[model samples]
Target: MERTGGETLLSLTIMSEYSETSSTETFSTFTGLGATSGKLIKRVGTVVVNGVDAILIRRRLNQLEATLGVWSYSTTDSEYVKSLYNDLLELSRPVYKPPIRLRALRLIMGRIEMMRFEDLATAVANWPISYSYGLLKTMILCFRDTLPLIDMSVGIERTEALVAYHYTGSHRAQKPEHCAAFLSWLGLTTSLSTPVFSRVLLQLDILSFVTEIYPTDDHLLRPSAIRFPRQRLLNALLIGLEPVNDAVLINQVHRIRTIFVWARFLNPPI
Candidate 1:
């Protein structure tokens, strides 16, 4: 989540465009332009998806309309819009290296109170497992606040929050494969009926893999896109390993051999 200190200037500037004109009315409402005005919006053009541009310029334009608008600086709408813009701005940075449309999708979600992620959901279905991993990570983080609503009780908030941290990172070599695979692995094999923790425990295998490979400097652990990001991978390991037993860690590493094998994460990407 974005801690405060977001870019207030730009947010203020954008909102000022729709600010009041020193009028006597305490509030001002702009009826918005005609549908033809859609032509005036700028396209975000060609967000990288799997080394190929996702060609989402059109949808990007639509998002700009819904999320960004002129508003008076001191009005109720303006403050809310400003806050939404700041969050969208946070999601826009390339530090995460996510696909542009994916980021925009999150930004749009951050602004709206209730919505479904239909557009990105469709785009990710055909994506490679690696790309899907990235998209999933962003969704989890953007919606991390909503975990309580989904839970029958709020007791496992910490545990649910941890799953959202699993899928995002810089390199395939360094990325953690904790979300989809872990969820699937537990769903199929577990007979315990309630495997919420199992959902998280399945990821311990990957947790152990990184611990083994990062220290050994081995070439057998490279995933094509799995190059590591310092903050992301480090923190993920820190969280995942907090509950680990040294002996259990050894067995866990052995369990996720297939993920590492398929990822071929050991080979360095040239």
Candidate 2:
């Protein structure tokens, strides 16, 4: 979806004429011939109305009227003024509604909170691909503070969850940095013991997947080649392995390093 920072509500140049016929006035009330007296307060200024500006301007005008007892009226030739009432009605109508994805995630998270470990795994496996990353991220963050308190049996479920989470990154619309950040958070928070770590790496086949997706020399050579950031993913992988002190895990880390070296050799420096 296309996103914008802000919207313009209205824009116009306003002209005002004030009557200065009050007896309290100390100065000349009329410059031109009139029954009482009048003063022209013509302001040639463009006012771009946005959020809260309309309300602020109205308040300022009201304050001026109350304090100085000066009665004034303004006119704008802009066609927008013709439908100002309708425009205000439109603005008054509610426009904020949560995205479908967010609502779905909230429901899923609620379901997950009451589920057994096996059921959680099943849910993760069956989760719609579009929102899998969101669900996984939410799960990780929810349990982050109480990782140590979690039962060991939940490790298997977490491993399955991670595997499912990894595949979510393959979605075309998925942001690489988001996936990378998720992995980094997982590594930093949860202590991925040998069995769980090994299962996640092997089940996901992360090494092979990374090799397949990493932009190769030929791809880089093409002028039209679309390169997305992979450095963050690589770093995330290394960080995820930081808690593993096993000799086998160390060898796996070295292999990952070798792949990095090969990738650097194939692709030219930016």
Q: Quickly count the clashes in candidate 2.
A: 0
Candidate 2 segments whose C-alpha is farther than 4 A from its true place? 1-202, 217-245
User: Each candidate: RMSD to true structure?
Assistant: 17.9, 23.0
Worst 10 residues of 2 by lDDT: 36-45
| Candidate 1 local lDDT, 1-270, one digit each (tens) | 122333112323223332322222233232232221121121211222221112222333344446442222233564444433433433343332334434454333322212222222222332334433433443334323334545555333333323323223211323233322222222222222222222243343334434443333333443423333212333333333425453454345344443544444554434
Q: lDDT score, residue 253, model 1?
A: 39
- Per-residue CA lDDT of candidate 2, range 62-93, in tens? 33223222122143433322222212112211
Best candidate (score: lDDT)? 2
Q: What is the lDDT of every predicted structure here? A: 0.33, 0.34
Local error of candidate 1 at residue 149 (angstroms): 21
Q: What ranges in model 1 sit over 4 Å off?
A: 1-113, 143-270
